[model samples]
Target: MTLASDDKVLILFRHAKAEQVYGKADHERSLTARGRRDAMAAGAWLHEHELGPELVLCSTAVRTRQTWEAAVDGGACGETVEFDDSIYSGGAQTVLQTVREAAGEAQVVMVVGHNPTMAALASGLSEGDGSSAAHECLAAGFPTSSIAVLRYAGPWSGLDIGTAALERCHVSRG
Candidate 1:
């Protein structure tokens, strides 16, 4: 289904900093104190910008879930938080597929997951319009609590590399 101009915002979020501990699976990692702060800051920015998400799709990983909880924290947003197991350790292409699958249900959808994938997905969908900061962040692997908004002009099923344009990119670290 082709997305309406008003129904085209796809916000990609990278999970916040994870507590350092060896031997534990990556999926079990939890956010650190600073990570919590950064997530909240990003959340504040989202709330301030009036970017209320209509749907939130997050990875089932511990860190991602924590980040979403702290960041959103009942802030200005619509209902529903769907946990997708595929995003736990998904790649850029997988992330894009996940977003495409849910394109028709909401005007704005937020996907909270891991880095490299999140960053790569942003870069892939972006038609080179991502800001220098965005490029830098994606190049460096999105840090804790980063958000990238991509505006797609076509149907989600047709979404491919460089099909969308990065409209906004923000990292709480800075």
Candidate 2:
């Protein structure tokens, strides 16, 4: 599927299961063993689907970083990876601001963070015209290591509620 010149692909990814008590701050907590496998599964799914992103905007938290690393190990590739502070605890709109501020020529952008921000953002951006099945899956709740693939024909700065269409949703579990 070819996109228009200004079209963009956005993949909203929620970090996998994280340790509740890691003897450190919540931001310092890392992914659990199962989380690693789930992350890898998510990566493999992306690879198989040819959804390789050109830019990855991830949270600065340890668990998010670990998830990205494990995803990479599983075959996910991105031209650039940016650890964004806003994504750490920023709400959905704040996270959208980060994407709006993104400076690059990347057409495919992936955001890795926690929820309900991740899920909220995905729901807010996607309209009702794409796939009913995808929306139904998302309505259930965004599980760990779940991803929502959205497509829009405009600049990132213009992305907002009902601006994009939810192409699909997937939950990868090890």
lDDT of 2 by residue, 1-174 (tens): 367789899999999999998467999988999999999999999898899888999999999999999999887888899999999989999999998889366789999999999889988998575799999988999999999999988778888998999999999998
How good is model 1 by TM-score?
0.88
Instruction: In model 2, state the lDDT of residue 70.
Output: 95
Q: What TM-score do all the candidates reach, one by one?
A: 0.88, 0.96
Reference-based lDDT, residue 50, model 2: 90
Worst 10 contiguous positions by lDDT, candidate 1: 1-10
The digit string of per-residue lDDT tens for model 1 on 13-81 reads: 888888989998878889998888888787887887677677888999999888888787635354678
Clashing pairs in 1: none
- Model 2: lDDT equals 0.91
Pairs clashing within candidate 2: none
